[model samples]
Target: MLGSLLLLWAGLLLLYFLWKTRRPKNFPPGPQPFPIFGNLLQLNLKNPMKDFEKLSKRYGKVYSVYFGGKPVVLLHGLQSVKEALMTRGVEFGGRPQGLLVNDINENKGVIIVNYGPSWKEQRRFAMSTLRNFGLGKLSMEERILEETSHLNSYIDKSAGQCLDPQTLFHNALSNVICAIMFGSHYNYEDQSFQSLIRMITENTKIINGPWGMLYDTIPLIRSLPLPFQKIFENRDKVKAFFQAKVTEHKETRVPGKPRDMIDCYLNEIDKRGNDGSSFDDGFMMVFLMDLFVAGTDTSSTTLRVGLLQLMMHPDVQARCQQEIDTVLGERKQVCYEDRHRMPYVQAVIHEVQRYGSVVPLSVFHATTQDTQVLGYSIPKGTMIIPNLSSVLYEEGQWKFPHDFNPSNFLNKEGEFVKPEAFVPFSLGPRMCLGEALARMELFLFFVTLLRRFQFHWPQDGGEPDLTPHFGIIQGPRPYRLGVRLRGRQSG
Candidate 1:
């Protein structure tokens, strides 16, 4: 009986392999797949971007690779990426489903939902909410300046000691997001607030990490509770926090005055009343979580990377400080417009984004209808990966694509000139919705922090490791630095 059962199981496994690896006619060329596993084993799961970048060199511009038996078309080089994302925006604007996506909000939010009317509504509402909340005006700048001051004060309290600024930076950014979404911000020492920040930051790291990608490629991994328990736990904690806030808003909402994004959404829901629009309480929770999480991780990580890059190149840091000193002398604070005056500083900031390429691979895009990228027919529902890392670091796009040089953004005359290759926020309609807001935060925070403090690798301690913890978003390995009030030096 045991022998017979084993034979039956082996035959079933054989059938599964035969069925799973079958490809459609005219599929783009790619590495051969193995039984059941597909091309996952070929990838360095911890650093998939490097593997993909390497693949692009051999496979030419448009190519396919199997991740867990599914074909993902990777558009390499700047031209192909632009042709797909920018030129054929609608054709390649849909979001594909995955374990992480479905498990959280069931693909309801702006980032994960399919390209359709629902996506259109949520995106429109989100942008409208930002506008109504003073996204680009002086009011928004005031809020950011307040949070920037909070970050500066925290560093001030450190008194030049060796301290990791990771959590501190996350806290300040979280406050800005909180104020925008929930109409309130938290103190850095608040225990509950700290917990929420960890939940958001850590899970994003895990989701972008190798294991996260692995689970994403294979849906079966989602059923195994033990491997990704912490991620799910964080998901639950964050949603619960959002839910609680929703409940509070529901109970305490005013009839006329809409205080924040949440209140605006809730009021919209009531007004819609039975129209069956996508404005339910559940949708509100997911949307807020989406905004909160997306808003927190990217900006904070950008700040962290910029700080590390500056520390490693003190000469560059000195030049930037000199520029800031010369440009905004005696102006206790900075606004977004100041970027125009400090060209070197602007170049360095842009370089940090290009070199880091935080979201190395953009959020997965899908073919809305039958599409062709570079003459390769991509069927409807095919997953599209416009490797922004490849575009940012593509050989011909930047003079020194491999190096972390600010000159990449500056020309012979030493003025800031943005290369067409610098699309860190990505492209097309589904591009990062918070692009402007994030740019504003990075500028204000970098200038504000540098103007007040000079950061350095500790004299008595070891040099900081520049190696990034590769994930969905690449960020510097956690390290401490010494900080003290800057002594103004002339250029």
Candidate 2:
């Protein structure tokens, strides 16, 4: 009886293997699959982009890879990414409902939702809300300048000592986001605010590890009463914090004038008056959470990477200082409009983003409908992942894809030249909603620090490790840097 059962199991396994090899005629070429698992076992999971780059070398710019049982078409190179994300934008606008994002936001927020009337309504409302809160106006500039001032003072208080700038930079970035979303800011010592920040950091760290992949493959694991429970508990903590803030905003809402995103959302809820569409309290809470997560981490990590780059390459740092000194001599604060005059500084910012490429694969994009790319048929509901790092570091597109070269963004005449492949904020309708705000913050914060202080490697040690600690976002390995006040003779 045992021998007979073993023979039957072997036959079933053979049949499954045979079925896995039979791909549709128009499907893109990829590694062959085995029984049950598909090609998922072959993927690195921890650092999938490295595997993705290797596959691109083998299977050309655009090809398909299977994650668990799902099909994901990976787009590489500048031309392919632009074609899929830009020219044929709407058809490929849906976001996938997977473990990492769905477990957190649950298809409600602007950043990770399917392309539909609901998504359209929420996105439109958000764009309008940001504009109402002085997104690109002098008022908005004042908010950023205020945050920069606070940040500079905090760094200056370090008294030219070496310290890890991560927490300080994170506080400044999170405050800017907080002011935009909540119409208020938290002091550095606020325990509740610090707890929220810790939650954000933990989520980013865990979601990029093996456990995240395990959850993605077998979501039922999240239901088990163990370590997975902590994920939900943490998520609830974040949601509850936002919910409380939303309730506060509702209580303080004025008749017509909106104060921040929460106020604008509350106003919309009042305006809609049981329209029963997308705008609701639940949506508002999720939207606020999305803004908190997306806006804070990416900007903070980029700035951290920028500071490390400056320490590593002091010549680049000196050039940026010279430009800031030349442009804003003795000015109390740097302004957004002054960015154009500081070409080298702008170039360095661009280089930092490109070199870091924080969101290496970007938030995963899915196909809303059946589509074809580069002569391969992408089925409806197929996952579309644009390898953002590939575009930023593509050999033909960048002068030194690996090095921190500001010239990559400069012309022969020494003016800053924006590269077409520079899509750090991504592309198409789903591009980062906080692009303008993030750019303004990075510019003001970076220039402010360079103008007042010089970032140098620690005097007691070897070199500060410049290697990145990749999470959902990539940032530099933790290291301390000396912050010496820049004197007039420096420039």
Candidate 3:
């Protein structure tokens, strides 16, 4: 009886394997799959980029990998990514519903929604709202400068002492988003604001680990009695928090004058009169959540990496200081417009983003329909990931792709030259929605801090580790830095 049972199981497994091997006609060729698991067993769930890079070399720039039954097409190299994302941009603009993003966002937000008329309408509304709120205007610049001043004061209070810097940076960055979204910034120590930050950070961390992959593969585990269940509960808590904020914003809506993103959205809702145009409270809440998540982490991580890079390469730091001193003099506050004059400072900022390459693999995009990428047919619904880090680190694209070199952005005449492949904001229709806001914040905050103090490695330590700690967003390993007020003579 035991021999008979084993034979039956073996036959079933063989049948499954045969079925899985029958690839769709014209689907991109990739590694083979096994029974039940597909090609999932071959991927390094912890760090899938390495696997994807290796496969790209084998299968050319565009290749496919199966995550369980799902086929994900990895778009590598600059040309391929640009072609698919830019030339035929909107056709491949749909966002895939990952286990975490789906549960947390529920298809309401601008960032992780499907490419349909609904998404188009919501995105248009958001773009218009941001413009109306002075996102690229002088008024917005003043608000950012105010936040930068507060940040400088906090760092000055630290007074050259060893500090974590994460919380301080996060507070400043989150406040910028808060001011834009909620019509006001919170005290750095406010319990509610702190809780919001903690929840967002926790969700980001949890969703990038093994359990996240497990949930994606077998969603039923989310309901199973396990520690992973807490992740779901926390997700709900985050959504509820945002929902409450939405309700408050709606109840306290001010007509004739829109103060923040919520107010602006509510005003639009009033104007449109709830005609199912995707400009409702639910969309507003998700949009706010998107800003909170993308705005906070990417800017903070870049600033953290910027400080670390400066510490390691003091020469570059000194150059930046010289430019700041020359441009702004000893006592003037830095403004967003100042970036145009401070070429070296701008170059350093660009290089920090290039070297850090925080969002290594951009948020996953799905082809809205069957598409041809580099002569290979990618079926509709095939996952598309633009390996953004690959472009940032491409050998031919930068002077020193692997090293932290600000000169990569400088021309022979020492003017800051924008590289064609500098795509930290990504390219095409689904590019980061917060690009302008993030750029403004980074410039203002970084210039403010540099003008006030000099950042350096701890005196007791040797060179600090520049190796990036990979999470959903890549950042430097935890390291303390010494900050001292920049004296007039030093400037």
Candidate 4:
């Protein structure tokens, strides 16, 4: 009787394996699957870019790999990614849902939610709110300059020493978004704000790691007492922080007088009440959290990586200072208009983004309708990973794709020329909504720091590692740099 049962179990497993691997005749080519795991065992688990590159070499530009039982198409090179995301955006703009999104956001917010009427409204409203809040005006520039002043003051008192810049970057960047979203900025020493920062930092680390991928791939096991359960718990704590803020705004909000983003959203909600949409308190909380994280992590990581890049290449740093001194002429503050006169600085900024490649994989996009790419059929609901590293480092798209050279964005005339492959903010309808604000922050903060201080390697002669920490953003590991006040040359 026992031997008969064992044979029956083995027979059932074989049938399931065969069913999972069976696909339509015209599906993209990929590695053979052993069983329910598919080619998941072949992946690197930590850095999937290397694995995807290997698969691309074996299969082709458009190929499929299964995570658990689900099929995911990995698009390699610039043309393949553009064909799917830019050309066929409406068909491929939807987001795939699983434990990572549904369990965390309840299938809410602008980035992770499926693209449709609700997503369109929320995204459009959010972008417009940012624009009305002075994303292009001197007011937005002033917000960044205010944070720069605080950052400079913090660094000034800790002068002549090596310092880890992680929290400093977070505090400054988060404050800018807070002032925009909540109508005020927190003090650097605020305990509650510090706790929120900790949650956001922890979230980025966990959400991009292998465990998060596993949870999404095999959500059935999520119900058990497992380590991955901490992600949901941490998510709740972060949500509660924003939820309380929403309540406070509800009680104190006035009619016809919007103070900040929260107020504007509240007014909109009241206007559209009982219309049966996703415009409510819960979605609003998730939206605010989305803005806070998107605004904070990538920009802060870029600024952090920017300092390390400059430290490694002092000549580039010196040239940037030279341009600033020659153009601005002892100006205490640099504005958005100043970028028009500073090409070298702009080139350096673009190069840092290309080299850093923070958010190496564009956010996962799903097909809302059946789509065909490169003469191959991509069924509706297929998950697409547009390998951004392939685009940023594509062979013919860049002059020096592998090096940390600023000439990648410069012409013979020393003017900044943006390459077609420079999609650091991604592209198409699902492109980064914070492009205007992020560009403003990057320029203002980069100029402000370089104008005031000179960053160098530690006095102990230990070299800082440029290898990324590989989270949501490919941030540098927590490292220290020697900071010194520069002369009035760049003032």
Compare the candidates by TM-score and give the number of the best one. Answer: 4
Residue lDDT tens for model 2, 1-491 = 99999999999877866675556779887887655566778886656678888999999999887666666788998888888888878877888876567757777878887899889999898887778777888888898888888877777777568877788778888999898888788888799999999987777767777777777767667767755556667888999999898887778778688777777777787888988888887777778888888889999999889988898899999989998999998777778889989999999999999999988787788888888888788878878889899999999888888888999999999999998999988899888888988888899889888888888887784766766776668778887867888862221
2 or 3, which is superior by TM-score? 2
TM-scores for every candidate against the unseen true structure: 0.94, 0.95, 0.94, 0.96
**lDDT at residue 124 of model 2 (Cα atoms):** 90
Lowest summed lDDT window (length 10), candidate 3: 482-491
* Cα lDDT of model 3 by residue, 1-491, tens digit: 99999999999888876676667877777888766566888987766777877888898887777776677778887988899999879878988876667777778878888899878888888788778788889878888888887877777677757777788888888888878887677888899889989988877877787777777777656677865666667766777887887788767776868778777777888888957688776777777788788879999989898998898888998888888889998667777888899889999999999999999888889989878877778777777889999899888988888888888999999898999999999899999877898888888888888877888778776766776776668888888878878863221
lDDT of every model, 2 decimals = 0.84, 0.83, 0.82, 0.86
lDDT of 2 at 377: 84
lDDT rank order: 4, 1, 2, 3
Error of 4 at 266 (Å): 0.4
Predicted candidate 4 versus true structure: per-residue lDDT over 132-244, tens digit per residue:
88988978888888999988998887667777788888899999999888877888889989999987777776778777777877767778877667767878898888888
RMSD of each: 2.5, 2.2, 2.3, 2.1
Candidate 2 has a TM-score of 0.95
Which portions of model 3 miss their true places by more than 4 Å?
2-7, 461-463, 488-491
TM-score of 3: 0.94
* Model 2 alpha-carbon drift over 4 Å, by segment: 10-14, 17-22, 488-491
lDDT of 1 by residue, 136-240 (tens): 888889999999888888887775576777888888888999998887879998999989887777777677666677677767667786456688788888889
Q: TM-score: which is higher, 2 or 4? A: 4
